[model samples]
Target: MQQRDSIVETRSFDHVPESERHGTVRTQVQFWFMVNATLITLFTGAVGPAMGLGLSWTLLAVVLGSVFGTLFQAFHGAQGPHMGLPQMIQSRVQFGSRGAVLPLAAATIVQFGFAIFFIQTASSSLAAITVDQIGLYDVLIGAVAVVLAIVGYNLLLRVEKFASYITLANLVLVTLAAVVVLPIGTMINNSAFEPVAFLAQFGAAATYQIAIAPIVSDYTRYLPSRTKGRAVSAAVFGGTLVSALWLESLGAALAIAMPDSDVITAIHDMGDSFGYGIGSVTMAVAVVACLITCSLSFYSGSVSFLSALEAFRTMKSTGKVRSVTIAIGGVIVIAGTLLLPADFLGAFTAFLSILGYFLIPWTAVNLTDYYIVRRGRYSITDILKPDGGIYGRWGVPGMISYALGFIAMVPFFSTAIYAGPVATALGGADIAFAVGLGISSCTYLLLTRRRDFSGEFDAVRAAPLNTLGEPQRSASASTDSMEGNIPV
Candidate 1:
């Protein structure tokens, strides 16, 4: 790990030494809280009301979905301290050093998509607050986020910890003001329940929470290895659940209050209802929160991109490499935001659904391999090998399970572009994510059952200590010792 006061983080894909481990579970809570409490989540919450679900049903769906999705997401956080590597880098264990590229590519796209959406939403809110120079706002916000990402992990945590307090206070005020100013009782009375609408709302909320799975561990990987798994999981679950439910429920209320207006404009109007200048302040705070999220996506996306590249060639985790990747990602985000369409909400809904679809199977396979099959014991030296050492170039069980899980979801998928037959018969309630999770988990377990892991366990035991106190062996030597030693 880099020095505590270093402005730019030096380590990228390398393992963090025990001596450098820092941070508490409390910081984890604040970081996740700040990340989820943003305009994007508010937009996600608005989906329920837009789908014609009553506020009551929207709230119920949000609660249930948040709980279910966060359960998977929070568990990923526990993997960070144990693996001491970037989330996707650790996936090399399940998917092989090379085969991990499949999930890495998906994770990279998801992060980029999130960065684009966050920047677009923040720019729109800024435009709503002042002049309509959305193009300029896009560049300005993207530049700030890129710089913050370049500054890297420690600084990002500091910024989020500070922003968490401000966002929390502002969100509470906005939620309270909406209840007093909006005709909530009238909106609830006017709307009626539809099963399809309720399920769609539930899916939206669930995916919104699950979207963080790929990057959740990136933030926690620097913590001490002895950190309690349950403590980390609980903190993450609590932080994400509370913030998401609050902003999303507020979004549902705002959508109910003004069905035709965009969420940002509706929030502005609601803030103005409280007072004259409060709307501008509220919008400004929202922009700050969104910027933090953009930085997070850029940072994690750059790390994932590097992990993917390592599958093909040797890559260094230097500051220069990190800066270049982030710069490239920022340019893409800026260009994408400039071309954003007018139907932002509709586009956002579809994006969330698709993002969740690709990610569900990957998360399912990863979590099962970690907690069930390998039981959190991994050989870091083998994971770093170009040929994948004991694990090999492609993880047959993981790859096949991922493909099978995705295939199983095809008939149940319900997206804007295509609705599967099962989905159509069930009134268009998309439960494809759940189906993928179950299929992937079960498939990976069943396939690995007959394989012998005793040799792999011995390799893990013989591996050098993951601390600065020990001198690590060359990659060649490590690979030579493990070659032909473990059975497939």
Candidate 2:
């Protein structure tokens, strides 16, 4: 295993060799647990009560949505170790080398969008806790997050592992305090469930979890190939689900008890009600968690952007490339945070809904291709081919299925900007994600039925080559090669 003490990760958009693979499945648990236990997820939970669902119904939505969404997202973790490549790059198998630019671009936008949201919320929390200068906080937080992203994988793991303990402890204490002090019981007893609100909240919760799919593997790709798929999937699913539920449930209760205040204010007021410096501590922890998640977004966004660039031309995956992309993305995130609209919660809900529309179909097609049709068989050499190797220049099946699935969801989309006719008729309940997932999966399966993979499997068995088309050397001898640029 390579030394984990390297300050900056050297590899990006390249296959991790067995010699470089390190880390245990437990790290996956810690990383995701910390990632989800943040202000963003708490806001997601608050969406239920904001939409008029009672506390009981909101909790139901949170549980159901987290379970359903995390199941699909967790399976993607297995692909990282098996392929030894970043998540979006692996899409080349289904979408073809160049054809994958479509999904890569979409994934990049999602990552950047997420970074903007995290920074926006964190800036607000920081301003509320200490400084009143939201703009200054935005720049400071964005700069710090970009630096962490530049340092890359190993450092992210260490930071998240340490953060997992702090976040978990804070959440447990807050949950207990809310239970004893809030009017959660009254909110539950006076509950009036609306189907539209229930479904909308459910969709929001599910998509909040699903949004992690495109980037989940970026953090896990360094794990040794022998890591069990089930073990990785279980760790990811359990950790994310637990943190999301704990925070979201508390968020729902907070919304019920303090409807006029924002999530940050509500959390701060709740902590202060206990009469120690707990309010400041909780706000500080929330900001720290948000910053960590923002760094994750920038890191994965850079990798996805580079993967798109590679589809157009061959380029070395150097540290310089990663740094440039992250720096550029960080600039956009900071600007967006400053210009955010007044209705933060409403805008955020719409953003999540739109995210689901774009991502659900892609996830469905990618997962179906990985688990069913291809069954973990792929060629690193062909996937890196400029013109695409055995997979061809464009995967007609995947592209067509993705488009068809996206089109199928149009009538069911519900948001403040536009409510589709079907959604309006159903009293504004959005079930577009479900429809997209079903259509994308079945369409891709049918389209690829007669396709043959014998040649692809043969290519997989052949000796892999680096981007220069030379036979690859052993990981130990090629430690300084463009593909194996691990710093000593």
Candidate 3:
């Protein structure tokens, strides 16, 4: 074994001890984490509100956003399996140790923000249900959500496969219920909900998808590199595309019937349209499915925030933070839920619109660093340093590129102020994400022309260890006689 000292400047990726790196995370444990974290069922519940808003627009958003988001995030996911590092550490190349704080903070906030959105909507909906059963217990629902967050990611990972399988079944049942509620001809031109009219729905859908993009790697990292692309495609299709369609269509049909009802009631009405037995089961499945999503969202978001907090120089100047951050985030989410209304679209869309602004730039920067400049290879050592690292501490080129993209995007996104209609006409944050990505990619290419071609791709592109978590001694970094093979 190589007796290498830990780099004082390098941020620790995960707490996985050196000994454990060759162990646990390699097998089924991590695979399930990816699958469950991508919870398609919970995504369905979220689309419910959009259904009432406009189904056609919702579906269009999923199709466009999922395709684009999946393609970009897949590049980031490529790093996890290839480099065996967390997203924040991977980001250090682009953001610098100090500058990394911005993306980290943005990711953390969006994660926790959405966690709050999902948990609140689910809890509030559950409260409405449980109140009739146990007599006015909304607080009870919120309390249960917090407890779920405390249980953390590992437990959730174990339950996710089971939850997702059941949730898929529930989706089939609900789709049938929607058909049952409104026979094909019984409903007015269902196409009316399509994007032909309401552009806001497209913007809303794009924003929502952007909000969820960061967590793609949290799940995909577990996948073996050979199938990483497949996993990415599957997650995009199943979680975003299919799930969004379910929510939008179901919500729309319910609205057409009741006009004034919320998503929960529409679902309830769907169940009622069937017999009492089917209704009871659908309601039960919906609640459980929503809880599964909220729990995962809260856990992922908490981890992101903790990673960001750790990046702060004043905090630890490393990419790690205290466990308490999770608890605090959960509490805040719970509080937000209580404060916000139960309508999923109101809170989720508003949050996503804000998230899309920064998230687009983050994605652009990472893609530029990984694909354009580094060409899918980076020095582990360079990324560990706080300053004057190989990639250069606080990469100004990357940061400036992101800033420029953000500047261009803001006028379109912040239309409520001066350029309201102009911003709206500019096509919301989704366009911002794309345009920023293009600009950042072009900037990185133009700036790093000579430096981009030096590394040996073969040595760097070693298959990502299914088990490794800690920064092991890479072949280049090792002094041991048996340098090539990592200790089993």
Candidate that scores best on lDDT: 1
lDDT of 3 by residue, 1-488 (tens): 21123221122244222331221233333333333232222343334233343444444554565555545544555455445456665677777766777777777777666655555445445554555532123345445555555554344555665666676776677667777766635454455553322444444444445555566555444344333433444444444444554554555456556666665665766676776555556666655655666665655666566555444443442312323555576667666656665455454655555665777877777766665555555555455444525555577877887788777765556423233344556433224555666776677667667653434332332313222223333545322322222211
Comparing 1 and 2 on lDDT, the stronger one: 1
Residue-wise C-alpha lDDT for candidate 1, range 1-488, written one tens digit per residue: 46767778877777777777899999999999987988878877877677778888888888998899899999998877767788888878888889899788888888978888888889888887789998999999999999999999998999999999998888778877787889888876765788887887788788778888999889998888778878888889999999999888888998988888877788888889987566788889989999999999999999999988987888767888999999999998899888877576466657656766887999999999888887775777777777787778899899999999999999988878678999999778888888999999999999999889877766675667421112453434444353432211
lDDT of every model, 2 decimals: 0.83, 0.82, 0.52
Error of 1 at 233 (Å): 0.9
lDDT for position 210 in model 1: 82
Kindly indicate the candidate among 1 and 2 with the higher TM-score.
1
Using lDDT as the measure, name the better of candidate 2 and candidate 3: 2
Model 2: residues with Cα > 4 Å off, grouped in runs: 1-5, 339-345, 348-352, 463-488
Residue pairs of candidate 2 with colliding backbone atoms: none
Tens digits of per-residue lDDT for model 2, 1-488: 23456677867787777778899998889988987988777777887788788999999998998899999889998887777889888888788888888888888887888888788778887877786888888899999999999999988888999998998888877877787779767988967798888987888788778878888889888888778788889888998999989988988889888999977788888988975666778989988999999999999989999988888889987777788889999998888888877467576657656765787888999999887887665667778777778777788899999999999999988888788899899777777888999999999999989988655554554537432223544334331332222111
Give the Å error, residue 138, model 2. Answer: 0.8
Clash number for model 3? 4
TM-scores, in order shown? 0.93, 0.92, 0.74
Arrange candidates by TM-score, highest first: which order?
1, 2, 3
Ranking by lDDT: 1, 2, 3
| Model 3: colliding residue pairs | 26-466, 56-193, 56-194, 415-420
**Which ten-residue region of model 1 has the weakest summed lDDT?**
466-475
Candidate 1 contains a number of clashing pairs equal to: 0
